[model samples]
Target: MAFLFPLSTFLLPAGGEYGDVRASFDEAKLNAYLAKSVPAVKAPVTIKQFKSNPTYFLTDARTVSIQTAHQVEREYTMLAAIHNYNSRPTTAPEARVPVPQVFVLCEDKEVIGTPFYIMEFLEGRIFTDMSMPGVPLEVRRECWLSAVRALGALSSLDPKDVGLEILIKSLSKVSLAQAAVKDIDTGEPVGEITGWRELIGWYESNLPDERKTGVRIVHGDYKLDNLIFHPTENRVIGILDWELCTLGSPLADLGNLTQPWVFDLADVGTLMVGFKNNPGAEPISLEDLEREYCRVTRQPYPIVEIGFARSWMLFRLSVIMQGIAARRARGQASSEQAHLYASFFNVLGRLARGVLEDEGYLPKSRAKL
Candidate 1:
């Protein structure tokens, strides 16, 4: 479903207008909830069609109107401030909400046949690049520095304090890794035989035994795009998208942000390059970001470890692309991008091999009969 906006007023119409045929929020119903929850409002509630991932509708008030049937624990979000009618305790009120400010939680299992959540429609923009645009280069590094510091602050939060330890611990399973060792869905790991072999070999051979004990609170999908920056202030206003948020190795968070997205650099320069050329912005390099993050976080450089993690990331991404390719090949998906995304996996696979080779995890010679 494609979204059509007024090009002037970024608001959702009374009915579904933006090629949004899927389950959507009932604005009337949501407004009623908000009106009851908070009495004197400054403006009429307007539900803006927001994210597609969790299928939510954002509002002009920067509060989420979630569509869910199940009762969610209000403690999971900004319930404290919502109940108090005050701002969050952590940051400045004018500063973008430090976290995705979730508002009303409604269920769609009955109304829309699926579940969704809503959050405040933030004022800032997602840069979608390695660098902060519209800022000077001297300050460009500081922008990322503050952004990384925010991430570190988030990581520093006690998992128990946030009640994420129990929730994420339940979700953190190595079954996927175990399954990769032995193909389950397919009769065997086909087309990716070498990739699989290399991955399993590296997992067993290279990773330190102490690595598994270092799990911590992770953003799960900690990429530049997931962060919202106040371009002028040069600080991360809010960290968005908590669906994949969990307690895991901090390396996992760093891996997702630093590791190339979709495909490695050889396959697609656009991932990082796109950040540099973000509208009205000057680009920054990946090296600068990584270095600054390490320095500020006081964490080990972990360059070799990051390299190993990159191989793991590529292997995981390949499985996803191949699945899409299979669907496209079967006419399940129509976009040519699906096919192109699939081929890009091949490039990542080659890059993963290079990573493993440099680490000496890959065999010097392939075993033969």
Candidate 2:
């Protein structure tokens, strides 16, 4: 299905002439149009499209007509925000997660009939399957570990420094102001202390411990496929899909990223939501990823937090599938295989409940999920 405005989704057409085809459209035509209309969109060789990977953004485009103006502004604004993050001198060295550079954002919607942007054409590898089939086990271990390190590096960045404070309240629901830098040793603001200048959403209530965690620019959707890896090395060359990016709990990204290991299809059967555990990389565990994340962030291993985050993410993924399924039922399915995801709603709910039970938050059940 061709998305108007592009990013892989750089284009899911809005109303007017593009009013209809939101549910289904020709990707080849869209790709060709992108190649012709946007010269900067090179081969996009790094971004490979796979139907099974579940990128279905099934929101109905009918009501989009009313929201078109607001949507246009929001879309272009986010593109600029991310570009700001990438263009910062300190971002590449500190975050270690590369973002495609936005050369220009055309919000007029007159040229392309929808908002679109020209981004750097990253040439690398995007493994749709989390298992990373055909790759060596050592490579898989290193690649996965590198992804963790990248996330940690991103989390450690101060949002204000990256020009991301403006997005916190509107997106992540946090208000940002310049507080004096805190000293790790003395536990007091060291810089010029100022009011309304602190990362206040540091404590997460969802976790068992009220530990103060670093506020990070959360990549709401962080997973293997969303990343572009170096063609030969195990390093991560780029991060994709910033639509869900925001300033929020680092745990949200960690939770979303680590769900694959927790929901091994062999162990949970129907409850397994997305990717399956790769038997080839059996030596590596979810804990290993957590260890790398903690090591990079210099934070203690958060066992309880991990459990909560994983279960929460499972429920969240299921809800997304459920929404797509609803759109499918309405005959507005953005892609062909949306029916495959409809059935996962109940099973994923069971998995989320099961995890809660295991953590002693819910009562145990004799019935198998």
Candidate 3:
């Protein structure tokens, strides 16, 4: 017997509709998209029950909440669209996915308040951390390889052919810089910090000085949790999350994926160890993972070349955390680990300064600061 439920209340957002910053999954539209696009899904079934399942697969924001059903469906459709845009042949990897006759939904705005698309749903298990106990070593390695290769394939795509010019054009330099800073969660402007280097220096130094393309499709948040794997098949069923999809340096995407692996080593084993099916079954070393990713992607080993990606990733994280810290400081949100957040701001400031100083982006007069 199959059972489904309304995961959560779909509340009309209270704040300004930021640029996909606080965007969320729209369940009604997701269902409609699937019903219209997929040939097999003829009727929309009523959500029988609604409950939340803790997703060991993602961070707090992406977890299944009141609207999990919608999120699942939305993610499925988005992944499908990306796959189609990539010119991924039906004969391509993980081709068993159902191909819907229709791809677009007409009542997208009415149901989800957005123009939404659809893709066939995939049934698979996800390992947020490659190092899990129940998973075999070989399977874990394959998962890592598949993820890196998928990212490489995505990076190698042609934006014009895939109809991604508009998405890429929508991004602004300020927004990108702000995003880099804001990810640290601090309220301070990146340039104002003392003694610390700016994050931009590191990015500029690490990435190719020349922009390869005006805009390349970027999966803003590329990480293990966002990847879906066909547990038994030893393959990635789909790449998930489109909320942050845009046109930017594909290197940014690569940087994001490998960031956690590089810095934050202290939390790597503890925070990620339990995410996979079995905790501590297969411990993946960062060195091995980095080497494999380089080989599969055919990019120079990032660990050897740029190293800015990791710095960029950390800088972004620090910025995000600082923003959170700032919010907490203002009494906007409660924080048990107030000290941790506070420390994040200081760390971000220092890191940013370090990066800028290293790249000569910081003015000579303020070298000490």
Candidate 4:
């Protein structure tokens, strides 16, 4: 059976303080939008904004959330997320999902500057850190394995089957290299971080032919925090934040999953602070996780050109972080962790440089922080 459940009857208190600093939406305007756009809801439906940053909302009987696309187009990512969720195969008995059923797409400038969509609110816990305190190690392991299965399931599907051919383009290693060059040429600011330019140059020069492969729908941000776990079990009930979903190498998702481990944040003053130090359970290594994922999917291990893939993914992330930093600087960012995100540009850049050096694409040299 589908993991369907009633919207939580009791309104849970907001997880954090609500204020101007936190991203929020106008309830009156949202209600007005709903009144006109979604026929299911009556005119006088109430909208309550959650205290969480990049505010989520709980309506009378449904949940509404907003996604603002500053660098990448929001509509495309939002639609992709919905499509992936709805189109995902239900073959796995254990893979229960409360996929978002987007009711309305609102682009009315008066409602909000950027476009937003209303979808079903899923009730579950979101573990933002690896250290799932108070949770059993076996349960944590199960959760991690469930996530891997979800990723494998997502990667195994054809993008064409879900009508994502146009919205999400398949990217090859060569295409990624070319895109890197294009970004640099367009003055995307390759800051004076030590190996930033060298890494790009490596990509431009060593474009590998064998790295080209079939495209899969990639959840750009596939981590424990983005997944919604069952209230009492280790199973993943729902996936959130499709803002970064795209068509790319499946390895990109793997790279994203393993990026945090590649760059330990013990002393980094970023958002992922305490979790690293106090991880309640011993985390699984990326290698073991990848092996199990390959075994479950019956796909060969991606052992070749793994380094290049890591560098490409990290470099792309650094570019994205740069855009976030720009938005935060201009007072246009919506994420409550905007400042923390802004601080990650250098850290990510250095990490990318480190990957390139390890891959023999660049000499062993530290990037100037």
**Which stretches of candidate 4 lie above 4 Å from their native place?**
1-39, 52-54, 62-98, 110-114, 166-190, 205-213, 266-282, 324-344, 359-361, 366-369
Superposed by TM-score, candidate 3 places the C-alpha of residue 169 at a distance from the truth, in angstroms, of 10
Model 3 TM-score relative to the real fold:
0.60
Better of 2 and 4 by TM-score: 4
Off by over 4 Å in 3: 1-40, 48-81, 86-109, 112-119, 166-197, 201-207, 210-215, 264-291, 297-305, 330-345, 348-369
lDDT per residue for candidate 1 within 256-298, as digits (tens), equals 6655422334346552332322333433455665676566556
Instruction: State the C-alpha lDDT per candidate.
Output: 0.49, 0.55, 0.47, 0.58
Best by lDDT: 4
Q: Which 10-residue window of candidate 3 scores lowest in summed lDDT?
A: 9-18
lDDT of 3 at 78: 42
Lowest summed-lDDT stretch of 10 residues in model 1? Answer: 1-10
Tens-digit lDDT track for model 4 on 167-264? 55332342333323323224553233335667677766865443344677677777767776676667676766665676657777766766655655
Candidate 2: stretches off by over 4 Å = 1-94, 165-211, 266-283
Q: What are the per-residue Cα lDDT tens digits for candidate 2 across 131-198?
A: 66567778888988888888887777666665665353331121111122233445453221111111
Better of 2 and 3 by lDDT: 2
User: lDDT tens digits, residues 96-196, model 3?
Assistant: 22222223333445665544333333445545443434656776777776676777667666566545433333212432443344323545543322222
How far residue 124's Cα lies from its native spot in candidate 2, in Å, is 0.5
Tell me model 4's lDDT, rounded to 2 decimals: 0.58
